[model samples]
Target: MGSGSAKTYRLAFNGTAGQYFGIWATNVALTILTLGIWSAWAKVRTKRYFLGNTTLD
Candidate 1:
């Protein structure tokens, strides 16, 4: 058992994590390459995906 920051956590493994990482990496690469428009989209996707996948009390 854990408390506070030590509380146990697990990945939902909804199976899109790998794809998310791929999108993240590709977005980062494109951001660097494009001087950063991809960053805006990446941030939006990341926020949406994170909120969509998270479960909280």
Candidate 2:
């Protein structure tokens, strides 16, 4: 009895929530200091950090 259905699997990962708070705090400080350009830097930094910390299987 095989009905075609999409089966999905998820990967398990663990990351530091504390570090995210720190990242946000630092981003705010840098943006205030650099006058908005640091916003882009912060976005890229956050993206890379998330991507690097993510795992796929």
Candidate 3:
């Protein structure tokens, strides 16, 4: 890197509270109904929502 205008990396979170709540609620319900058996899938979906919304700018 030179002393000139250096490159910069920015990270952003674009997830809204409502969107996250919806996903979280769905996961909770499914997990409960399945007697915690669906918890793994629910956790995956929850993680995916956050990961997908995270952006690099």
Candidate 4:
């Protein structure tokens, strides 16, 4: 690679639908049970799930 060459990276998501469904279901159930109070935690959980399953190469 040349010094001035631009670096390229590929962003990939490796999360399966089943895995996400489980998270989504739990978040939904908890959010409803807590009267929307769990939404903040659910957002964090969802973000972590996606970020954890993503890769850069």
- Candidate 4 per-residue lDDT, tens place, 1-57, comes to 567978799999999999999999999999999999999999999999999999999
Model 1, global lDDT = 0.76
Models 1 onward score TM values of 0.55, 0.75, 0.81, 0.89
Screening candidate 4 with a backbone cut-off below 3 angstroms (N, C-alpha, C), the clashing residue pairs are none
Off by over 4 Å in 3: 1-6
Tens digits of lDDT, candidate 1, 1-57 = 557585576655243868689878888898999898778888888777777776643
lDDT of 2 by residue, 1-57 (tens): 789897777776556999888998999999999999899999998998788788876
Predicted candidate 3 versus true structure: per-residue lDDT over 1-57, tens digit per residue: 577997799999999999999988988998899899989998899899989999988
* Cα error, candidate 2, residue 53 (Å): 0.9
Taken over the whole model, the C-alpha lDDT of each candidate is 0.76, 0.87, 0.91, 0.98
Relative to the unseen true structure, what is the C-alpha lDDT of residue 12 in candidate 3, on a scale of 0 to 100?
99
Off by over 4 Å in 1: 1-16
Clashes of each: 0, 0, 0, 0
If both were scored by lDDT, which would come out higher, candidate 2 or candidate 3?
A: 3
- The TM-score of predicted model 1 comes to 0.55
lDDT-best of 1 and 2:
2
